[model samples]
Target: MTYSLLNLAFLVPAAVLALVATLRVPHRRRFLRGLGLTLLVVLVLTAIFDNVMIGIGLVAYEREHLSGVFIGIAPIEDFSYAVFAAVVLPSLWSLLRPSRRRPRAHA
Candidate 1:
């Protein structure tokens, strides 16, 4: 298939949201840096998973009408899923942690 301009449009918003979320972590900037490092790890894992699936005949590509990018057996669009999951996972994990609000004393 010809590259979908519509599909390609998604990357801008995804990257913007990742940037915004990473910048909003209260005073824990170091945590955000570590989160970015973690995201790299997650991206690698997802790419490997997708590669294995494609290798085992679990997924197939329509090569004749395909978009022009590939990573080994995986398509370029496929890797974006990995990037998206990596960026989102840390933001979601931070939300699950308890907040640091101090207890108020009785008046």
Candidate 2:
């Protein structure tokens, strides 16, 4: 299989878990859209900065095995960092917010 496709093995599962974790919190839809859009912006900014740094040889990918898709000189793995950031930030944000409603009385 191609290197790009090989990455799906990790990215897809991590994304699925992220989605599931995000959805498990109540009021998810109310916040998820805004959170996702915010993450998109952060992702783009970080990707550009990271790729440029890699291109300039400031830091390097230690892993020899990498998906060869390059944004300039950075590997696709760089973008995956954004995905994790998107998932994790939102999950933590939800965890921090206090619940708005108390549980209903048990019958």
Candidate 3:
């Protein structure tokens, strides 16, 4: 399978997991804002580091596996890992943590 299709295999599930976590997570607006910021930083770092690696020949793509899309010689497929990390980590935390809602008191 091509790299893009391979990435879709994992990304789709992670996206679903993130959506479910969002529902469980309180403070919806805050969570979304944090998620956005995390994604921005992770993607930016990936772009910079990936380009450096590809440029220095420390990394290489088969070209046939790639979709021919690139950011500074780093294949677009390389960025999927960054996206996955950014989405999945916070989501898993939200899912695993106990709910803050307290039990109701009986009068």
User: What lDDT tens digits, residue by residue, belong to model 1 across residues 1-107?
Assistant: 34345345665666666676666667567766777787778767867888899999998766764677877777776766656666666666665668788999999
Candidate 2 C-alpha lDDT tens digits along 2-49: 445565676687667667757777767766786788788977887789
Residue-by-residue lDDT tens digits, candidate 3, 1-107: 79999999999999998999889787888888999999999999999999999899998888888999888889999999999999999999888988888999999
What global local distance difference test value does model 1 have? 0.70
RMSD of each: 3.0, 4.3, 1.5
Better of 1 and 3 by lDDT: 3
Q: Model 3: runs farther than 4 Å from truth?
A: 102-107
User: Local distance difference test, per candidate?
Assistant: 0.70, 0.72, 0.93
Provide the TM-score for each candidate, comma-separated: 0.68, 0.65, 0.92
Model 3 C-alpha lDDT versus the unseen true structure: 0.93
Order the numbered candidates by TM-score, best leading: 3, 1, 2
Best by the TM-score measure:
3
